[model samples]
Target: MNAPTVPVLQVHQLTKSVQLEDEVLHILESVELTINPSESVAIVGPSGSGKSTLLSLLAGLDQPSSGSIELMGKPFHDLSEDGRAAARAGTVGFVFQNFQLLPALTALENVMLPLELQGARDAEAKARHFMDEVGLGHRLNHQPGRLSGGEQQRVAIARAFATQPALLFADEPTGNLDSANSQKVEDLLFKLNAEFGTTLVLVTHDRELAKRCQRTLVLDNGTLVEAAHASTGA
Candidate 1:
């Protein structure tokens, strides 16, 4: 018999609550889902609909009030803070709308940070390879202030992929780009995923971007629902 596969990410009864003096805000509620390895998924919703909150929880960056999560077959919600950090270090990558590059670091240094942190001896070589992959080899020594928004985001994408994580969490990866740059970044994102078999979980308001994913999860006022199929459902 063939070996069974494990989900790249899994969640059950996930929820987040916050106190606001006399009232409680439920940021997420009873959310449950699973993502297979190498799958690309999008989480879409209006502002304050808990899309980002869900992403944070799924990535184990934020704690949920009640529920469970498993990332890469390891317990997420149940892990201690230090343990969760270790888990993330091993199997997660992230890209943000703001690009989140360190102003003091050059594109090459920015791409090398993660590998260096992991004590890889070949960080520079690996970073250079990814930077070249993202078409930034010519700009490797440029600092964030010297690069355009698109270039900065490309640097960010290069950094995110240097670790080759099992899953990539992208929060509005193209939110800050112009239409042309956005399309370029989008094309690169898909190409990287298909090439690396990295499971992608993106939180985006862009319908076109979401449509490119293999699956879409819609969040509405803290509830989770899978988007309807185009041809199989009305």
Candidate 2:
């Protein structure tokens, strides 16, 4: 039989630090983690515990001060900015807490942007389909300012999925919403995950949302610890 495939993401001895005036502030220490393909995992921790830092590193949005990260069988540290961007274009999608949609662009335009960037010929049609999937069909022509927070987030989700990314990273995706809207977004997120088999890595404070994932990794002062199965609802 064939050997098991390597994980989609691997981090080894990752560390990060910054110089401040006269002292070096250590933000992360020897962080190590692995995320398999199509797996859903949550990173939960208090503010400033380096949860966002770890997510950025995993997504190739930022580099570690030491050690290495491998994604999709490529060494992340070895890739240049352009190369990393290309890699992400091919394999990763990110949903920000602020819904990062371009204010000037309509919802449909925002959702179509990535596909167009990738030179896909059917960008419009594909974007439309994903918008409908996220229950944003009626809001296609609306700009970010005109939509509700939940609607804006749904558009962001559609944009992220438009690329059919192998991995999805979400940073406090429901942070700005009320409970009802948060639940709605959460349901949509899992629905898309189930339908597309997209691996999920979420950084959140919501225990209920974290519980829905297959595994949860807790970060404390930048070091990682596996949470109990009960904590993860695994």
Best by TM-score: 1
Instruction: Count clashing residue pairs in model 1.
Output: 0
Model 2 per-residue lDDT tens digits across residues 1-234: 988887889889999898999999888999888899888899999988989988888888888899899997779866888888878885899999999999999999999999999999999999999999999899999999999999999999999999999999999999999899999998888889878989999999998899989898999987899897653322
lDDT of 1 by residue, 83-146 (tens): 8899999489999999999999999999999999999999999999999999999999999999
List candidate 2 segments past 4 Å from native: 230-234
TM-score of 1: 0.96
lDDT of each: 0.91, 0.90
- Off-target runs (Cα >4 Å) in candidate 1 are 229-234
Worst 10 residues of 1 by lDDT: 225-234
- What is the alpha-carbon lDDT for the whole of candidate 2? 0.90
